[model samples]
Target: MFAVDTSPRSRTRQYSTSSSSSTRSMAQRDSMDIDSAALLDIQRALDIARNTEGDLDHSVEKYLEEQLTGVWNRLESRPNTYVLSKDEFAIFNYFVGRYQDSKVAEKAIARFWSSYQDTGSS
Candidate 1:
C-alpha cells in the first residue's frame, strides 16, 4: 500500500512581504506631488484627459492647452512671484512633451521662458 501525506504550510512571512510591497507601491502612486500649484494643475488636466477622452493625443493637447492658459498667463505676469526653478521647468517640460510633440513643446517652452526674460524676472 502506498500512502501520501498532505500538510498545510505557514504563509505569514510570505504574505507580509507581498502585502507591504503592494501597499508601498500604492502609496507612491497615490502621493505624487511636485510642490508647485501649476504642476499640480497640469497633473489634474492630464488625469482628466486620460480618464475622459478616448483620443489620447487630441485630448492631451486640448486639455493641457485649456487648463494651462491661466497658469501661463500668471507666470508671465508675475515672473518673480511664480519663478520656474530648474526642477519646475524640467517637470513642466516633461508634462508638455508627454502630451504633445517634443519639438512643438520645446518651441512653446522657449516662448514662455522668453516672456520671463522680457519681464526682467528670473
Candidate 2:
C-alpha cells in the first residue's frame, strides 16, 4: 500500500521507473536535437567550402569571413546572442585548423569562440 503525506515538508516520495525513464528520454531527445542542428550547420559550411575552388587557405578565409559577418550582424541586433553552439564551433575549428594559414583569421575565430563560451548561453 502507498501512503500520501499532506505536510508542508514530506521527505519520503515514490517515483515510478517509467517516469524517470521518460525524463531521461526527454533529455536525450533535446541533446540529439542540438547535435542535429549542429550537423546541418557544418554541412552548410562544407557546401560553401566545396563551391569555391582555389587555394584552400583563401577559401577557408573567405568562408570564415562570411560566417563572422553573419554572426556580427546578429550580434549587432541582439547583444546577448550566441553565434553558434559548441558542436558547430568544433566543426568550424576543425576546418580552420585544416586550411588556415593566416594567424589573423585564426585569432578572430578563436576570440569569437571564447566570447560565445563566456556568454553561458545556448
Candidate 3:
C-alpha cells in the first residue's frame, strides 16, 4: 500500500549473493538500489528543509501531511493495528525525517503494529 509506483519499497546499503559457478574466489556483493518512494521522499524532504532553519520535525510534518492520510487509511482498515503509544510523534518524526525515507517509515510503522504488546502500565 505504500508504494505509489511500480517500484520497490525498501533497500539496504549492502547485499550479498552466493556464487556457486563463479570463476572469482569471492562472492558477488553490491549496494541495493533504494525504491522510488524512498527516493521521492528524500527529494521532497530536502526540498522542504532547503530554507528551513533548525528543527527537522517541521520538515517531517510537511512530508507526513502529504502521506499520512494514505498510510492511516491502510492502518485503520486492519483490526488490532496502530496502537496508541506515547512515542508516536517521536517515532513518526524519526522515521519520516531522519533519513528522508518514507517507504522505510511505512514499513517501520507496520512492524511496530505487529510487534506492539501492551504492558498495561502506560
Best by lDDT: 2
lDDT for predicted candidate 1 compared with the true structure = 0.41
- Once fitted onto the true fold, the runs of candidate 2 whose alpha carbons sit more than 4 angstroms away are 1-56, 81-83, 87-122
Give model 1 RMSD, 1 decimal. Answer: 22.7
Candidate with maximal TM-score:
1
The TM-score of predicted model 2 comes to 0.27
TM-score of each: 0.28, 0.27, 0.27
lDDT of 2 by residue, 1-122 (tens): 11122337322122111122343333233323343223223344444345534433233345455554544443345434334444334445655654377544455466566766666575
Q: How accurate is candidate 3 locally (lDDT)?
A: 0.38
Query: Per-residue alpha-carbon lDDT of model 1 for 1-122, expressed as tens digits?
Result: 11111226211111001122342332223223222222233444445344542333343355455435534454555544454533335446545645465444454466557755766663
Candidate 1 TM-score over all chains jointly: 0.28
**Each candidate's root-mean-square deviation in Å?**
22.7, 19.6, 14.7
Q: In angstroms, give how far residue 119 of model 2 lies from its true place.
A: 13
lDDT agreement with native, every candidate: 0.41, 0.42, 0.38
**Which regions in candidate 3 have their CA more than 4 angstroms from the true location?**
1-39, 42-51, 54-63, 82-91, 94-122
